[model samples]
Target: MSRVCELTGKGPMSGNTISHANNKTRRRFLPNLNEVTLMSDALGQSFKLRISAAALRSVDHRGGLDGYLAKAKDDELSSNALKIKKEIAKAQAAA
Candidate 1:
């Protein structure tokens, strides 16, 4: 699987690794991705997602999966996450 955050769309960033010898080499800064199951309060279901640690904190800060998806940009979300977002929206709207 690709090393990307499903929630935040975080990917590896290109950078340089500087050494003590004043040498620089190309390097990649990868996001800290973890597989976690987050529960949606609105949908009352748990969804497994590959997300960064920072995104996890943001989710908790926002409240939960439903709250996080509410403020998330469509472009930043993965297909699965987008589907969940839509379902949550539909459910909340029905209620």
Candidate 2:
């Protein structure tokens, strides 16, 4: 899989590596991505996702996966995550 944060849609960013002699070299700054299994309270299921460290903190701050997904922008989510978000919404609505 590519080095991208599934939850945040964070990908490698292009930049420059400056040397002491003021030489600039092209470089890529990648997000701190990790594979984590997060639980959904609404669906009572767990899903594994590759996400950034910042996104992980946001997930916790929002109370969990369900909450974060509720507030997340649809375009930022991967297809798999979008499906889970919809399922959680459906389950919550049915409850």
Candidate 3:
């Protein structure tokens, strides 16, 4: 897989790496990504997703990611992805 956060849609960022001598070099800023097995409630199974730390935080900030997975485990959007639509729905309900 590419150096990206599939969950958060985070991709490589272009930037400059400055040296102590005031020299600058082109570099890429990558997100903190982890390969984790996320549970899908709808499919009654677990799927792997390459997600960034920020993305994980976003999910966690809204109550709990575990709760979202638990709720989704019983739905058809259980595998492959946690499902953007379901997450939006949950967020709206909480609001």
TM agreement with the true structure for every prediction: 0.97, 0.98, 0.62
TM-score, predicted candidate 2 vs. hidden true structure: 0.98
Instruction: Report the lDDT of model 3 for residue 56.
Output: 69
| lDDT, each prediction | 0.96, 0.95, 0.62
lDDT of 3 by residue, 12-74 (tens): 899999999989999998888898776544334565778888766766765555554444433
Model 1: runs farther than 4 Å from truth?
none
Colliding pairs, model 1? none
Stronger candidate by TM-score (1 vs 3): 1
lDDT preference between candidates 2 and 3, better one? 2
For 7-61, candidate 2 gives per-residue lDDT tens digits of 9999999999999999999999999999999999988889999999999999999
Instruction: List clash counts for every candidate, in order.
Output: 0, 0, 8
Stretches of model 3 off by over 4 angstroms after superposition = 63-95
Could you say which candidate leads in lDDT?
1
Q: Of 2 and 3, which scores higher on TM-score? A: 2
Point out where model 2 deviates above 4 Å: none
